[model samples]
Target: MSYDKDDKRTHLELIQNVVTRMASNSFAIKGWTITLVAALMALSAASGTAKLFFFIAYVPLLAFWILDGYFLSLEKIYRKIYDYVAKDKITNEEYFSLNMTLYISRYNQIENNKYSGFKHVVDACITKTIFPFYIGLTVLVSVVFTLAL
Candidate 1:
């Protein structure tokens, strides 16, 4: 298929937009997790119910951690799409195709079954960027709570 150079550029730009949005969403989730946890901790300390609020805080923390990991995985997938598109690894038929399943299947085939869907999200959760921050926060909160008891 004969494609316009401009069209390819526009399609790549669209994919890039999705990637950027995923990254932004991840950042926002992290911010909210920290803010909510801190607020809950402060309230607990002030209310003399550190045990209850500290336990409650874990719920949001774990929820946000999972959410953040999900977004990060999406970002990784879009990034792979962008790389494929930029390198012309994808055929002309797939040009401007934002369908992720097509790319994911292709990736799985290329990687020889190394790409399990849920495993990707779990991997994102343990990445250096995501794991350290959340785990550190959890540890800090646990220590403070323990001392408060």
Candidate 2:
């Protein structure tokens, strides 16, 4: 775990990298949401009809958001694992596999931070709002919207 000569800059850099990655992900999803919302709104205005299908696209997107949040929580678990290795609770073998998986476990350029605290806000805000929104929207579109069609 702990490396010799671990400078503050390195930790800060890691945090910055994680933030950048997350910002990029958010940008992509939000960008799509805006585009979709615009299209739906425009269609509603033109046809004088509102369709819920516009929001349906966000369902899987929110699922992905929540899944990423789960991974961020795993980062905290990794800290505990790192501590175990540091304290001799786990040996070098355990650490080696973890180190190896770091690079292999990427999900479409999203690296496994294994220590970032991104999950804190995601759990609090995303679960309460975004997740339920996705679910409710999906159900609405699937049942009620389909009936409209």
lDDT (C-alpha, whole model) for all candidates? 0.90, 0.47
- Runs with alpha carbons beyond 4 Å of true place in candidate 2: 1-3, 7-12, 48-100, 103-126, 132-149
Best by lDDT: 1
- Model 1 ranges off by over 4 Å: none
TM-scores for all candidates: the values are 0.92, 0.38
Candidate 1 lDDT tens digits, 1-149: 66577877998999999999999999999999999999998998899788899799899999999999999999999999999888777876687899998898887898776677789999999999899999999998899889988
Model 2, total clashes: 1
Query: Could you give the C-alpha RMSD of every candidate to the true structure, in order shown?
Result: 1.5, 8.9
How far out, in Å, is residue 134 in model 1?
0.2
